[model samples]
Target chain A: MTKLNKKEKELVHLLKENARLSSEDLGQMVGLPSSKVQSLIQSWQKDGIILKHTTLFNEEKLESTHDTIRALIEVSIRPEKKTGFDAIARRICKHPNVIDHYLISGNYDFLIIVEGKSLQEISSFVSNTLASIENVRSTGTHFILKKYKENGIALGTEEMENRILVSA
Target chain B: MSPGFSHLIETIPSSGIRRFFDLVASSKDVISLGVGEPDFPTPWPAREEAISSIEQGLTSYTSNSGLIECRRAIAAYIEERFGATYGPEKEIIITNGVSEGVDITLRTLLNPGDEVIVPEPNYVCYAPLIQLAGGKVVAIDTSQTGFLPNKQAIKSAITAKTKAIILCSPNNPTGQVIPKKILKDIADLAENHDFWVIADEIYAELSYDEPFVSFAALEGTFPRTILMNGFSKAFAMTGWRLGYLCAPQEFIARALKIHQYSALCAPIMAQYAAIQALQGMKVVQDMRRSYEMRRNLFVGRLNEMGLDTAMPKGAFYCFPSIQKTGLSSEEFALKLLEKARVAVVPGSVFGLGGEGYVRCCYATHIDLLKEALTRISNFLKKR
Candidate 1:
């Protein structure tokens, strides 16, 4: 029912392909003036289709080179306090660098997977940032020692098939 | 936008295939044969062409109808490949993918309370999208006819409120192709009954042994058919989101208004790459040969195992009955993943007629096919 007009559709198409495109560049891509592009972006921001503009940084390039710091945290709450827990989880999720978070099952009220530079950063965040919140009682952290795969694909052939590790 | 925001959204069903894939991804050590995409990378030349187009500042928007040269190339390619002809300028509308083309066409054609007679088990999108368009979907199960719609059943399914019938050849779960005679019969039915025929021929070029017949290509059916297709399957350009709708000039005009509003146009770089793909007929032919090989290998082995697969006349999948194993298709698929470590789609995901079957996609490596079949054999043995 929220049908995008021609210009809005053009805006969405550009954003879907490259969220990094500058408003001026996006305008150029859709044959609109720079000012018009800025306006469209503003409207899109309000409409929520252009949910947020953020960088998808190359993790290897970050100062925290340890990929092992990645952990999935699950928190469980009482059934009656589901709304309060959800609010608390949403607050944690607004952090600038959080990758993905989900509301999941089996003993967990919330599942938060965040990438950190080191275990200390994660520990400090849990102690100071996460634990400080009200109605947040328990948390489980699983340090990713080796990532056989990430996202929806295998990281390498070794993940797809069991291959013997050859040492030099 | 309106009071029915939640209600309207709540009525449409989420994609079953998408849901299954998410579950499989979360599970451990599952070798997925569930994905419908070709495992092959986008052809180097097409990739290079797209990269160069961006580099040369050809990234700017083309007309809403799409790049002129691309549209012309599509017209020429369709004429040469399927013997269908249309004016590229006024009759073609580029879309994000065949999914979007299907979505836009339904939304544009259906008024409130209109009926869409869809043949099942078929692709997952048809019914949900039609409902989202404020139309009611009347599903006609095609399982009894080996996934091809019978003339009598289709005739019986139609009513005065029936506005259109969605036809998917080389169908999703069953891989059944409507033969020329049957195609013509359906076309004649549409003509006599005064209903639109939304022909989804996305797998047109992927037809293995049998030839594909486009609904628009049939004599006297051109006026009422809206031909939908995309480059994802045939050209291995799934990520690019380049698809199009070819219809009569009048319908194209109306659809373009919706297209212009909903998607404006497809990606500019993808359109440029499609121009290259059209020029490169060899690329289409090569992919066809490989998919045919994969389809043949998987289906052939399944039959040898006595899995009872109906001959898949087109597309790169085989729907084999698992009734002998004494499990529902969902149960069979879950057991296979947990035991054999191979992931496949349960046929029920496609809709009503697919309950006892599983759709195994073979658009993967030959070695993977062999391994999956071996796993299948072992799973059957333990039962």
Candidate 2:
């Protein structure tokens, strides 16, 4: 991987902290004109340095009725000679329930995070769809109990407390 | 009848910096570049330590010289970073803040009628603190030399009654670090004139381009130099009220007596947090990087707006000359706050050499800074 210049590194870190910040604000942060920042961001996007900008949700705030089941599925796959794990990974991600998937390095070839309406629904889908796929070896599924943090944001009631302003 | 206050207390003017801060607080929708503080909160580890210390009931007073472990951490940090050696047992005293450290050092070193040389356009508290210590302040005009005091000025300022000189590196308002050559020359002067050097290094860790040089680290100056530093600027622990003073054994012994009677010691919780801060060097580096980026942005924007500003080598403030706007520093600041809803400190508040400029702190959110700059641009165009 290529190393980012000082300005690029700062821009990336600031965006990671609060991606909702506007180009003007980012420009002010990294010492570029707004128009210049806009162009630089465009170039970064074209170069794939920035894959996406997303929001972090506080799931606890949702009504209990809206709560859903989520699980991490570690898949051991037998890679076909031509396609390796890429084909199987792509096919697995095609499921609407699969929120995120990553190629892995341990006993598992792929680690996938998926969400469903209920435990039974997720189990049925996993057994029927994931296990039935060709060249699939074995899978280990683990349900997520709670999320204390997500996407660099703390997900708890404590974060809502007011902070006292301090001056020097 | 009410007891009367001291004549010195009554005669000394209130801090001009505080006056501007109050004005900012009263106004609505004002974007301020007036505060000399870090925008970042204290690092998580330090805050966590403080919280845990309180949870564990570590709230009582510490030793008069502060917790020995905290002093050891500070000593290790200085030795590792600045190559300065001082015994933690006898050479250091934890202070409420560098503010208290400055006051204590001044009081310990100065006698009635003693004179101390102070550079103008500097941190506002130094001269007043000197006067409060019963010392006369001899002001040196460093504005003509790019805010760095020259050797000749120091020599000229020295007299039989001259006892010490106060120096702030990576200084406030002006943001100039005294160069190593200049520091060596000053050390030479100190030795020749037999005067002490009180170095306020509160912003030492925030230097962008060069490693900070400590006055005490220089040969022959350690004994005469009282080095003051703290967690406020570097670790973003301003509200914690933690700092320290390091000098020769004799000086620290004297200052410790004042500290015992007046302040006793820094808060026990803050001292615990400060220990964590010493271990959390990576966080300080991260904050420093952010401040460096903001400094570049703010100074570049000012220069593009036709304001002549020196690129600050350290700290989060930019001192820009408003002489081009054809207004006095106070006039410029008041008009900007009134018309643009952007608050900045008038440079004259700092001292004699600061009359034509204003101090704008860049330690604010980037969006607010952007808006403030736009408003300032608009206000200037209207003028």
Candidate 3:
């Protein structure tokens, strides 16, 4: 991978902090014209420098009925002839319960993060859907107990203290 | 209802920067680069600790100096980070903010008509606070020296009546850090001339290019340096009203008396929050990293738009020369605000040597900064 220049790295960092920042603002920050900043952002998106923009919901603040259960499931898989773990990983990820799946270098071939309405639902999905797959060898499930942080933001029940509109 | 105010209070000019902030507050659809504080909220752990402390009924007033435990944390933090040592009990007095710390230190140290060498363009509060404390402010213009005061200029400004020199590193408005060699020279001059060094290191943690050097940590300068710092800039705790003044035992003892009669002590809950902040330097580092990115972007953009701005080594402000636009600093700032709805402080508000520039704070949301810059660019084009 080619290393990003200082400005590009700063652009990435700023976007990471607040992706809602407009092109004009990004331009002002990195010393580029708005047109130039827009083009650069386009190229970044095209080149996979920017994968996707997503919102970070403060789940604790929301009034919701379902308390979702999330677990990290480490999967040891039997490699197929040509595709190795890719085919099996794709099949497992096709399940709607799988929020994220990553190929790994550890003892396990894949680390998958799965979420469901309840612990029983996740367990049944793992047994009926994930384990029933042909290439699946074994699985180790570790349920999340608490979320201290997510998406570079702290997950907490506390509301942010209101700042003065302007200060010196 | 019509009681007369003090003559001294009447004479002191209202902060020009605050005037712009007021204008910003009242106006709609305005993108303000006028504020000096950070955009980030205080880190969660610190705020959480403060809430918990209050819930646990730790709301009583701390000692005149501050909580001993908080003082100890500050002492260890200073020693570990900046290689400076001070006894937490005798050398540090927690104040409401650096504002109060500066106020009381001057009141304690200065007699009437004593001169204080203040380098400008600088922070707005220093000169007025000097006057309020009965000290004559001798402002040495640092415009020609990249906003870093040279030793010769400082020495030339000093006189027998000179009581102290006020220094701000990673300075406000200009965002320049004094070079270490020159700072050392200034320290040496303080030693030879027997003047106090009041170093405002509130922005110390925000330095981008180099590790911040505490004036008190310098050889032979520890005895004479009054180092002031707070959680305002670094930990985004401005509203928490927590700051400290650290000096020699005798100096602190005198300053403590002034603090006792006036503000008494910093907020107890805030002090507990500060202890948590000291424990959580990682949060400070994260915030500093964000500020560094913003600094580079803001400074670079200003320069690109034909405004000659010094790359800020620390702090979140960028001082951009508006002379090229053929407008007075105030005229340029007012025009920008009136036409573009983008608010920035006229640099002259910071005092002498500041007339040809404007101070743009980059601590706002990046989107607002971009919109402000776009408006500024359009305004410049029309000009």
Candidate 4:
């Protein structure tokens, strides 16, 4: 990957905060032409710097409606002679139920976040599917209890803007 | 005797902004772009410092010149940032805000009937304050000059009675920064005319496109300048009501006497808080960047909506011309509120040369700002 310039970094951070800003607005914010802004964003997308522009929803808010349990699974795997952890990490992370995956350091080789219908469903997946992988040694699964915040938005508490109606 | 007020007080009209405030307050679901101060709170560390000072019972008012440490910090900050210098002990006096600073400066300098030339479409308070101080306000109309102050016009307005010209670059309603060349020319005029320059540089820190040069820093202009600034807009502490005045020893001494008798000293906790405020330059820069982004977004969209808005080089406001909308600024402001539930200030509230325009403040959450712009766009389409 190429090193990002200052303007590119600003664009990235701005888009991270607000993915919905228009190219014209991004141009003004970063001091670039609108056409150039669109192309830079396209290049960043192609370069895999921007994985996706997606909304963050609070799963805790849907507890009364949706039947979903999120889990974080730690997998200890033996590295291949050449491919290291990348080969098995990719295989274990491609499951449809995996919400997020990362190759971690220390005792655990891989730490993945997965969502399923219930705690039983997540535990079964960790035992049956994840442990069955080639270089996987063992697995540990922990289900999430609650999330106080999601993607910078706090749950339950409302953001109130109380300004005097008009002031000099 | 009990019923009558002073002639000076009675002559001054009440604020034109009151009616609009009432209109905005009576409505619900309105996204208002009318406030003049920053949306952000005083930065956290400074607030914490104020809390600590209060809890420790360090709330006694310092010297009338304000806490010595705060004056020193302000002097150093002005020197480093705007290349201006003043002795903290003799030349700087903390005031209740720029509002009180202006009043004291006028009361100290102006003789009855002394003319003070104020460029119009300026802040609303300058004229009233000048009148109350028994000074004649010689108004200079800069609306014809892209809202930029013209040296020739100011020179024409000058008289032997002209005591000072109140300079508010990065001004309130129209965000015009007086250019360096023009400032040099104006300084020359003041030097030749032998009149004072009351510089209201409250918005100096918020200039975007050009670097702000304090008028007092210009050669020979120091003697002619009574510089007023505060921790209001720039520090996001408007409610704290803390500001200071810096000038020559004699000017500051006289202004200090007036401040001493009236407002006395700024709150002790706020003085301590301002010392801490000087340390948060990063927090200020972040707020400036956010304001710049919003200024860009709002100004660009206003132009697209057929309202011609000049991008304000500084300050949070954009004064866009609504003449093309086929309504007076007041009519446009009222109708927009009624039809779209979006509130903006009628430019007339800013005084002369503000008739055909509207002032929109961009110091709000971007989400609400975006929604307000959308409502305004729809309102214009319907028009």
Give a tens-digit lDDT track for model 1, residues B1-383: 56556688887777667777666777776666787766666666888899999999987777888988999999988888898888999888889999999998998899999999999998888888998899999998888887889899999999999999999897886878889888898988999999999999988888877678888788898888999888988887877889999998899888888888877889999998888877666867767766665665577668888899987887777899998888999999888988898888888888878899998877766656777888999989888
**lDDT of each candidate versus the true structure:** 0.79, 0.88, 0.87, 0.89
Candidate 3 accuracy as TM-score: 0.82
User: Residue B338: error of model 3 in Å?
Assistant: 1.1
Tell me candidate 4's fraction of native contacts, as a decimal between 0 and 1.
Answer: 0.58
Model 2, B255-342: lDDT tens digits are 9999999999899999999999888899899889888877877887788888899999998888999999999999999899999998
Badly placed stretches (over 4 Å) of model 4 are: A58-160
DockQ of each model against the real complex? 0.01, 0.27, 0.28, 0.46
Better of 1 and 3 by lDDT: 3
Chain B TM-score of model 4, please?
Answer: 0.98
The residue-by-residue lDDT of candidate 4 on B126-167, one tens digit each, is 999999999999998889998877999999999889999998
Instruction: Tell me the deviation in Å of residue A130 in model 1.
Output: 73
Q: What would the DockQ be for model 2? A: 0.27
All candidates' TM-scores? 0.69, 0.87, 0.82, 0.87
CA RMSD of each candidate after superposition = 22.8, 3.7, 5.3, 3.5
**Candidate no. 4 TM-score:** 0.87
Which residue pairs show collisions in model 1? Answer: A75-A109
Candidate 2: list runs displaced more than 4 Å.
A1-8, A14-44, A53-86, A103-111, A115-148, A155-168
lDDT of 2 by residue, A1-168 (tens): 758788778778888877877786678667778898788789888988889998776777778735688999988899999999888888999999898999989778888999998999899878999989998899899999988878766676343112222123
C-alpha RMSD (angstroms) for model 3: 5.3
